[model samples]
Target chain A: MKTLALFVVVITGAMLIYAGHDLPAFGDINSPSYQAPMTQYFINNSLEESGVTNIVTALLASYRGYDTLGETAVIFTAGMAVMLLLRRRER
Target chain B: MSRIQESVIIRTIVRIMVPFIELFALYVIMHGASGPGGGFQGGVIFGAAIILYTMIYGIAEGKKKMSDSLDRILASTGLTIYAATGLICIVCGGMFLQYRAVPLLPDPAEVSKYLIDLVEIGIGITVLAVMISLFFDVSPPESEPEEAEE
Candidate 1:
């Protein structure tokens, strides 16, 4: 198990290093992370349409909420599993 | 907890500061749509409120206010609100949570924008509740109210 873990970590580190080369130039202001496409769309349309001040908030709450919902479900399942494990059994 | 209770000065200061911290959390939750803050950030703040309750008063007192049953229900309810909202979008004859198909208002494009924010609120609540449950599950047995504080 320890060897397997070490192998997994090494492969993950290698993949990250490879991917890092193609990454968007370490945070350029005009890069996709900065002034990219989707943020602009949310900024242009959702602000006045939704009457929300923060464009990022509007995007997260509205556009990507489905993904967020799935995340919540995942957490709920984990909590339930833990409860089953730890809660004392009835005599 | 024992340390905090032992220090009179820390106790007085935290007691005074907790309300203000909680107020900031509420502000984060409410004003999430306008700025960098939103449901997720605000929800974490809400969890922090409970953490404060646990720290100062002890886990038993905290657990009195929030039991295992409460955490389970909250965790489930949060997910239900989120999933149900998505199912509503599907029932309205759209793809899974595809807001354009939901017929929210006369101006289809307009509602699409607003629907996103509402969905985000549901997401925030669910995620926060679940995270709190997870936090407690991994908490040391020393902190388990049934074992110690109770």
Candidate 2:
């Protein structure tokens, strides 16, 4: 069992390291992500479009509001589930 | 916990620090648009404050501070706030979650910004409620009968 676990960990680590090479180098301006039109659009217009200086916040809360809503619902569901599972009934 | 309660200095310091921790959490949530924070981060910090309170004090005392009923209400309220904001936009003849359609504000950008802040606040409330509730549910009061006897 120990050997099997070690083998699995080594294989996963190797796969991740192999895949890491395909990632763009640190802060490469000419990277594909930086060149994407959506990236440029968000960078140039996020402030004027959302009136928020923080690009990430504007993106998450305004541009991608639906996703955040779903996230909030997910947390609410988790809380409800915990309550259902652990709460004691009044006798 | 018994050791923690015995140390007067530790208790005093924690009591003082909890308010500051909570204040910082609020600052993070409110200033998310301008700085590097938002609902989730702030909510976690706020939850941490309560958890700290629970740790230093007892679970019973923590329950007194934030009862189960209050936790559920706050959690539901946050989700309601998020959904209602989106529904209002739909009623205004725009797509769901579209802030530009809301006519309360003049500029589209300004309206979007305001709605984003509201959404952030809702998210923070939900996250904070859920965290505290989860902690309490997982570690319930084990001394109910002992207290009842007393």
Candidate 3:
């Protein structure tokens, strides 16, 4: 079982390393991500639209606020689950 | 674990550092609008402070600081704040979570920024409370259940 797990890890690591070659270089301006229309729109107007200097914060808290709300719910649920499962009956 | 816990240096350092850790966490949450932090990161950091305190001081002491009831209240309050903000937007004639339409501020962009900060705060509060609660629940006093059963 340990050998099989090791084999799986080695295969997956090799695949990931091979895939890395196709990725854009760090901070490459001409990268496909940088050229996306949405990326350009965010860069151009996030400050004006959201009044936030940080683009990531603007996107998370305003443009994608609903998604953040859902994520908060997920965290809350997980906490509740842990509390319920592990709580001892206080006498 | 008991030997380390009893070490005066370890206890003294943790006692001194916990307040600073908490302060930094608050800074991260507040400065997240203009910097490299947000609700999740800040919340986790804040939670870590309490967890560290619990580890050093024992669960009973930790519980004294943040009771189970308080933990539950704080967790719900964070979610409530987020949901209430969305509801306010809806009441103000906008879709849910539409910060610009809330009409609290004249400038739409300013409104968005303000709401974003508020939402981040709510996330921070919930995440911090939940993390503390999870730690306490998962690592209860080993003799607690046996004592109760007896």
Please, what are the lDDT tens digits per residue for candidate 2 over residues B6-119? 588988898999999999999999999999999999998998888778777778888888988899999999889899999999999888998889998789888988888888
Which wins on TM-score, candidate 1 or candidate 2? Answer: 2
List iRMS for all predictions.
3.2, 0.9, 0.8
If candidate 2 were superposed on the true structure by all CA atoms, what would the RMSD be? 4.3
| Alpha-carbon shift of residue B104 in model 2 (angstroms) | 1.3
The CA lDDT at B136 in model 1 is: 61
Q: Give the Å error, residue B121, model 3.
A: 0.9
Which of the two candidates, 2 or 3, achieves a greater DockQ against the reference? 2
Q: What is the C-alpha lDDT of each candidate?
A: 0.66, 0.86, 0.87
Over 4 Å off, model 2: A88-91, B143-150
lDDT of 3 by residue, A1-91 (tens): 9999999999999999999999999999999999999999998999998899999999998888899899999999999987777664653
Candidate 2 lDDT, A7-90, residue by residue in tens:
999999999999999999999998999999999999999999889999999899888898989989998998898788767563
C-alpha RMSD by candidate, in order? 4.9, 4.3, 4.2
Per-residue alpha-carbon lDDT of candidate 1 for residues B60-124, written as tens digits (9 for 90 to 100):
66677677778777767767766776788789987676666777688765666566556656655
Off by over 4 Å in 3: A88-91, B142-150
* lDDT score of residue B141 within candidate 1: 52
Model 2, B146: alpha-carbon shift in Å? 19
- Give the poorly placed runs of model 1, Cα more than 4 Å off: A1-24, A29-43, A48-53, A88-91, B100-117, B140-150
lDDT of 3 by residue, B1-150 (tens): 577778999999999999999999999998879999988889989988888888888888888889999999999999999999999999999999988888877899888888888888999999999888878776756422111110
Instruction: Give residue A2's error in model 2 in angstroms.
Output: 2.0
